[model samples]
Target: MSYEIKKQRILELIAEMVEIDVNEVKEDSDFADLGIDSLMALELAVYLERDYNIFIKEHELMNLRKVEDLLSFLKTN
Candidate 1:
Protein backbone atom coordinates (compact mmCIF):
# COMPACT_ATOMS: atom_id res chain seq x y z
CA MET A 1 0.00 0.00 0.00
CA SER A 2 0.97 3.63 -0.45
CA TYR A 3 2.54 5.52 2.39
CA GLU A 4 -0.38 7.89 2.78
CA ILE A 5 -2.85 5.05 2.79
CA LYS A 6 -0.83 3.09 5.32
CA LYS A 7 -0.47 6.18 7.46
CA GLN A 8 -4.22 6.71 7.44
CA ARG A 9 -4.75 3.12 8.41
CA ILE A 10 -2.29 3.45 11.26
CA LEU A 11 -4.17 6.47 12.50
CA GLU A 12 -7.45 4.65 12.29
CA LEU A 13 -6.03 1.69 14.16
CA ILE A 14 -4.69 3.91 16.87
CA ALA A 15 -8.04 5.67 17.18
CA GLU A 16 -9.81 2.36 17.53
CA MET A 17 -7.35 0.95 20.04
CA VAL A 18 -7.55 4.08 22.16
CA GLU A 19 -11.30 4.30 21.87
CA ILE A 20 -11.15 7.80 20.51
CA ASP A 21 -13.10 9.21 17.60
CA VAL A 22 -10.94 9.05 14.50
CA ASN A 23 -12.01 12.59 13.68
CA GLU A 24 -10.41 13.77 16.87
CA VAL A 25 -7.10 12.22 15.94
CA LYS A 26 -4.59 14.38 14.08
CA GLU A 27 -1.10 13.83 12.79
CA ASP A 28 0.12 16.17 15.47
CA SER A 29 -1.88 14.66 18.29
CA ASP A 30 0.29 13.39 21.11
CA PHE A 31 -0.72 9.99 22.41
CA ALA A 32 -0.59 11.18 25.98
CA ASP A 33 -2.61 14.21 25.08
CA LEU A 34 -5.28 11.90 23.81
CA GLY A 35 -5.37 10.11 27.18
CA ILE A 36 -3.18 7.27 25.98
CA ASP A 37 -1.01 6.19 28.88
CA SER A 38 1.97 3.84 28.85
CA LEU A 39 -0.28 0.84 29.36
CA MET A 40 -2.41 1.89 26.43
CA ALA A 41 0.70 2.48 24.36
CA LEU A 42 1.88 -1.05 25.11
CA GLU A 43 -1.46 -2.34 23.97
CA LEU A 44 -1.21 -0.23 20.85
CA ALA A 45 2.26 -1.56 20.17
CA VAL A 46 1.01 -5.12 20.44
CA TYR A 47 -1.82 -4.40 18.05
CA LEU A 48 0.44 -2.65 15.57
CA GLU A 49 2.91 -5.50 15.55
CA ARG A 50 0.15 -8.08 15.26
CA ASP A 51 -1.86 -6.25 12.63
CA TYR A 52 1.00 -4.88 10.53
CA ASN A 53 3.76 -7.36 11.32
CA ILE A 54 5.95 -4.51 12.45
CA PHE A 55 8.00 -4.40 15.61
CA ILE A 56 8.55 -1.14 17.41
CA LYS A 57 10.65 -0.89 20.51
CA GLU A 58 9.09 0.50 23.65
CA HIS A 59 11.76 3.18 23.93
CA GLU A 60 11.22 4.12 20.33
CA LEU A 61 7.54 4.45 21.07
CA MET A 62 8.42 7.24 23.49
CA ASN A 63 9.95 9.10 20.57
CA LEU A 64 6.80 8.70 18.55
CA ARG A 65 5.57 12.20 19.21
CA LYS A 66 3.19 12.28 16.26
CA VAL A 67 1.32 10.03 13.89
CA GLU A 68 3.60 10.92 11.00
CA ASP A 69 6.60 9.86 13.03
CA LEU A 70 5.02 6.46 13.51
CA LEU A 71 4.20 6.18 9.82
CA SER A 72 7.71 7.13 8.84
CA PHE A 73 9.21 4.57 11.17
CA LEU A 74 6.89 1.83 10.00
CA LYS A 75 7.50 2.70 6.37
CA THR A 76 11.28 2.73 6.68
CA ASN A 77 11.55 -0.31 8.92
Candidate 2:
Protein backbone atom coordinates (compact mmCIF):
# COMPACT_ATOMS: atom_id res chain seq x y z
CA MET A 1 0.00 0.00 0.00
CA SER A 2 1.03 3.59 -0.52
CA TYR A 3 2.44 5.59 2.32
CA GLU A 4 -0.59 7.87 2.43
CA ILE A 5 -2.90 4.88 2.67
CA LYS A 6 -0.74 3.31 5.32
CA LYS A 7 -0.70 6.59 7.19
CA GLN A 8 -4.48 6.62 7.32
CA ARG A 9 -4.56 3.02 8.48
CA ILE A 10 -2.04 3.80 11.17
CA LEU A 11 -4.20 6.68 12.32
CA GLU A 12 -7.22 4.41 12.50
CA LEU A 13 -5.25 1.83 14.44
CA ILE A 14 -4.08 4.44 16.92
CA ALA A 15 -7.58 5.79 17.42
CA GLU A 16 -9.01 2.31 17.90
CA MET A 17 -6.31 1.28 20.32
CA VAL A 18 -6.68 4.46 22.31
CA GLU A 19 -10.46 4.18 22.38
CA ILE A 20 -10.88 7.41 20.51
CA ASP A 21 -12.59 8.40 17.28
CA VAL A 22 -10.54 8.09 14.11
CA ASN A 23 -11.54 11.60 13.06
CA GLU A 24 -9.88 12.87 16.19
CA VAL A 25 -6.50 11.79 14.87
CA LYS A 26 -4.40 14.34 13.05
CA GLU A 27 -0.90 14.55 11.63
CA ASP A 28 0.15 16.99 14.32
CA SER A 29 -1.79 15.29 17.10
CA ASP A 30 0.32 14.27 20.08
CA PHE A 31 -0.38 10.93 21.69
CA ALA A 32 0.03 12.17 25.23
CA ASP A 33 -2.14 15.12 24.47
CA LEU A 34 -4.81 12.68 23.46
CA GLY A 35 -4.54 10.87 26.81
CA ILE A 36 -2.37 8.05 25.54
CA ASP A 37 0.01 6.90 28.23
CA SER A 38 2.99 4.56 28.12
CA LEU A 39 0.80 1.56 28.83
CA MET A 40 -1.42 2.45 25.91
CA ALA A 41 1.63 3.06 23.76
CA LEU A 42 2.99 -0.35 24.64
CA GLU A 43 -0.28 -1.87 23.60
CA LEU A 44 -0.15 0.11 20.40
CA ALA A 45 3.37 -1.15 19.70
CA VAL A 46 2.26 -4.72 20.18
CA TYR A 47 -0.62 -4.26 17.78
CA LEU A 48 1.63 -2.62 15.21
CA GLU A 49 4.12 -5.45 15.28
CA ARG A 50 1.49 -8.12 15.27
CA ASP A 51 -0.82 -6.73 12.60
CA TYR A 52 1.48 -4.62 10.48
CA ASN A 53 4.78 -6.37 11.12
CA ILE A 54 6.21 -2.99 12.14
CA PHE A 55 8.50 -3.29 15.09
CA ILE A 56 9.24 -0.29 17.25
CA LYS A 57 11.52 0.08 20.21
CA GLU A 58 10.07 1.40 23.44
CA HIS A 59 12.62 4.17 23.55
CA GLU A 60 11.80 5.14 20.00
CA LEU A 61 8.17 5.36 21.03
CA MET A 62 9.16 8.15 23.37
CA ASN A 63 9.89 10.30 20.35
CA LEU A 64 6.65 9.38 18.69
CA ARG A 65 4.60 12.18 20.20
CA LYS A 66 3.02 13.19 16.92
CA VAL A 67 1.32 11.13 14.25
CA GLU A 68 3.58 12.69 11.65
CA ASP A 69 6.63 11.57 13.56
CA LEU A 70 5.44 7.97 13.64
CA LEU A 71 4.64 8.03 9.96
CA SER A 72 8.03 9.48 9.13
CA PHE A 73 9.75 6.85 11.24
CA LEU A 74 7.78 4.06 9.57
CA LYS A 75 8.57 5.42 6.13
CA THR A 76 12.26 5.58 6.90
CA ASN A 77 12.51 2.25 8.72
Candidate 3:
Protein backbone atom coordinates (compact mmCIF):
# COMPACT_ATOMS: atom_id res chain seq x y z
CA MET A 1 0.00 0.00 0.00
CA SER A 2 0.99 3.60 -0.47
CA TYR A 3 2.32 5.66 2.40
CA GLU A 4 -0.68 7.95 2.56
CA ILE A 5 -3.10 5.02 2.64
CA LYS A 6 -1.12 3.31 5.36
CA LYS A 7 -0.86 6.52 7.33
CA GLN A 8 -4.60 7.06 7.18
CA ARG A 9 -5.25 3.48 8.24
CA ILE A 10 -2.90 3.85 11.17
CA LEU A 11 -4.64 7.01 12.23
CA GLU A 12 -7.99 5.32 11.97
CA LEU A 13 -6.76 2.40 13.99
CA ILE A 14 -5.46 4.73 16.67
CA ALA A 15 -8.73 6.61 16.75
CA GLU A 16 -10.70 3.40 17.13
CA MET A 17 -8.41 2.16 19.87
CA VAL A 18 -8.73 5.44 21.76
CA GLU A 19 -12.50 5.70 21.28
CA ILE A 20 -12.16 8.98 19.44
CA ASP A 21 -13.04 10.31 16.04
CA VAL A 22 -10.46 9.73 13.31
CA ASN A 23 -10.42 13.45 12.57
CA GLU A 24 -9.07 14.10 16.06
CA VAL A 25 -5.91 12.13 15.40
CA LYS A 26 -3.37 14.73 14.40
CA GLU A 27 -0.24 13.60 12.58
CA ASP A 28 2.09 15.68 14.76
CA SER A 29 0.27 15.28 18.08
CA ASP A 30 1.88 13.40 20.92
CA PHE A 31 0.19 10.09 21.72
CA ALA A 32 -0.23 11.20 25.31
CA ASP A 33 -1.97 14.33 24.14
CA LEU A 34 -4.35 12.10 22.22
CA GLY A 35 -5.11 10.11 25.39
CA ILE A 36 -2.98 7.18 24.34
CA ASP A 37 -1.07 5.82 27.31
CA SER A 38 1.71 3.25 27.23
CA LEU A 39 -0.72 0.36 27.36
CA MET A 40 -2.69 1.78 24.48
CA ALA A 41 0.50 2.31 22.53
CA LEU A 42 1.53 -1.27 23.15
CA GLU A 43 -1.86 -2.47 22.08
CA LEU A 44 -1.50 -0.46 18.92
CA ALA A 45 1.89 -1.99 18.27
CA VAL A 46 0.46 -5.45 18.76
CA TYR A 47 -2.37 -4.77 16.36
CA LEU A 48 -0.01 -3.40 13.79
CA GLU A 49 2.34 -6.34 14.13
CA ARG A 50 -0.45 -8.83 13.89
CA ASP A 51 -2.47 -7.22 11.14
CA TYR A 52 0.31 -5.61 9.14
CA ASN A 53 2.88 -8.38 9.59
CA ILE A 54 5.43 -6.02 11.11
CA PHE A 55 7.47 -6.44 14.26
CA ILE A 56 8.22 -3.73 16.77
CA LYS A 57 10.71 -3.90 19.58
CA GLU A 58 10.05 -2.46 23.04
CA HIS A 59 12.79 0.15 22.59
CA GLU A 60 11.30 1.29 19.34
CA LEU A 61 7.97 1.68 21.08
CA MET A 62 9.53 4.15 23.48
CA ASN A 63 10.64 6.37 20.62
CA LEU A 64 7.18 6.61 19.09
CA ARG A 65 6.22 9.72 20.98
CA LYS A 66 4.12 11.26 18.26
CA VAL A 67 1.84 10.07 15.47
CA GLU A 68 4.42 11.22 12.95
CA ASP A 69 7.08 9.13 14.61
CA LEU A 70 4.95 6.02 14.39
CA LEU A 71 4.02 6.81 10.81
CA SER A 72 7.64 7.28 9.88
CA PHE A 73 8.57 3.96 11.44
CA LEU A 74 5.77 2.22 9.56
CA LYS A 75 6.78 3.89 6.35
CA THR A 76 10.31 2.59 6.46
CA ASN A 77 9.69 -0.77 8.12
Candidate 4:
Protein backbone atom coordinates (compact mmCIF):
# COMPACT_ATOMS: atom_id res chain seq x y z
CA MET A 1 0.00 0.00 0.00
CA SER A 2 0.99 3.61 -0.46
CA TYR A 3 2.17 5.76 2.45
CA GLU A 4 -0.96 7.92 2.53
CA ILE A 5 -3.25 4.90 2.44
CA LYS A 6 -1.35 3.17 5.24
CA LYS A 7 -1.31 6.33 7.28
CA GLN A 8 -5.03 6.82 6.87
CA ARG A 9 -5.72 3.22 7.84
CA ILE A 10 -3.58 3.60 10.95
CA LEU A 11 -5.41 6.74 11.94
CA GLU A 12 -8.75 5.10 11.25
CA LEU A 13 -7.86 2.17 13.49
CA ILE A 14 -6.74 4.49 16.25
CA ALA A 15 -9.81 6.67 15.89
CA GLU A 16 -12.11 3.69 16.00
CA MET A 17 -10.30 2.31 19.04
CA VAL A 18 -10.62 5.59 20.89
CA GLU A 19 -14.08 6.33 19.64
CA ILE A 20 -12.90 9.57 18.10
CA ASP A 21 -13.21 11.03 14.63
CA VAL A 22 -10.48 10.35 12.08
CA ASN A 23 -10.10 14.08 11.43
CA GLU A 24 -9.16 14.49 15.07
CA VAL A 25 -5.98 12.45 14.62
CA LYS A 26 -3.30 14.68 13.22
CA GLU A 27 -0.04 13.40 11.76
CA ASP A 28 1.86 14.55 14.81
CA SER A 29 -0.71 13.67 17.39
CA ASP A 30 0.66 11.58 20.27
CA PHE A 31 -1.43 8.68 21.44
CA ALA A 32 -0.70 9.28 25.11
CA ASP A 33 -1.52 12.94 24.72
CA LEU A 34 -4.71 11.94 22.92
CA GLY A 35 -5.93 9.97 25.96
CA ILE A 36 -4.98 6.54 24.70
CA ASP A 37 -4.57 4.47 27.80
CA SER A 38 -2.90 1.05 28.10
CA LEU A 39 -6.02 -0.78 27.08
CA MET A 40 -6.38 1.28 23.97
CA ALA A 41 -2.74 0.80 23.12
CA LEU A 42 -3.17 -2.96 23.30
CA GLU A 43 -6.21 -2.71 21.11
CA LEU A 44 -4.25 -0.72 18.56
CA ALA A 45 -1.46 -3.29 18.53
CA VAL A 46 -3.87 -6.12 18.01
CA TYR A 47 -5.71 -4.29 15.29
CA LEU A 48 -2.52 -3.43 13.44
CA GLU A 49 -1.36 -7.01 13.72
CA ARG A 50 -4.61 -8.40 12.40
CA ASP A 51 -5.30 -5.78 9.77
CA TYR A 52 -1.85 -4.98 8.43
CA ASN A 53 0.10 -8.01 9.66
CA ILE A 54 2.43 -5.71 11.52
CA PHE A 55 3.50 -7.44 14.68
CA ILE A 56 4.13 -4.56 16.97
CA LYS A 57 6.38 -5.01 19.93
CA GLU A 58 5.61 -3.14 23.14
CA HIS A 59 8.72 -1.01 22.78
CA GLU A 60 8.00 -0.40 19.12
CA LEU A 61 4.69 1.01 20.15
CA MET A 62 6.60 3.57 22.18
CA ASN A 63 8.33 4.66 19.00
CA LEU A 64 4.97 5.17 17.38
CA ARG A 65 4.47 8.57 18.89
CA LYS A 66 2.89 10.04 15.79
CA VAL A 67 1.22 8.99 12.58
CA GLU A 68 4.32 10.00 10.66
CA ASP A 69 6.38 7.57 12.72
CA LEU A 70 4.12 4.78 11.60
CA LEU A 71 4.26 5.90 7.99
CA SER A 72 8.02 6.05 8.09
CA PHE A 73 8.24 2.60 9.55
CA LEU A 74 5.86 1.22 6.98
CA LYS A 75 7.79 2.81 4.17
CA THR A 76 11.17 1.61 5.32
CA ASN A 77 10.23 -1.89 6.52
Tell me the tens digit of each residue's lDDT in model 3 across 1-77: 77788788999999998889999999898999889999998899899888788788999999899999998898889
1-77: candidate 1 lDDT, tens digit per residue: 57777777878888887888888889888777877788877787887788777888979988887776777788797
TM-score of each: 0.79, 0.84, 0.92, 0.78
Q: Which candidate achieves the best lDDT against the true structure? A: 3
- Give the deviation of candidate 4 from the true structure as CA RMSD: 1.7
lDDT winner between candidates 1 and 3: 3
**Backbone clash count, each prediction separately:** 0, 0, 0, 0
Query: Where is model 4 poorest over a 10-residue stretch in terms of lDDT?
Result: 65-74
| Candidate 2: residue 55 lDDT (0-100) | 93
Q: Which order, best to worst by lDDT?
A: 3, 2, 1, 4
4-62 per-residue lDDT for model 4 (tens digits): 78788888887887788999988788777778887777787787788788887898877
Task: Judge candidate 4 at residue 18 and give its lDDT.
Answer: 76
Candidate 2 Cα errors over 4 Å, as ranges: none
Q: Judge candidate 3 at residue 72 and give its lDDT.
A: 85
> What's the CA RMSD of model 2 in angstroms?
1.4
lDDT of 2 by residue, 1-77 (tens): 67788788889988987788999998899888888888988887887788778899978989888888888988987
Give the Cα-based TM-score of candidate 1 against the true structure: 0.79
Candidate 1 off by > 4 Å: none
Give me the runs in candidate 4 sitting further than 4 Å from their true place: none
Q: List the residue pairs that clash in candidate 4.
A: none
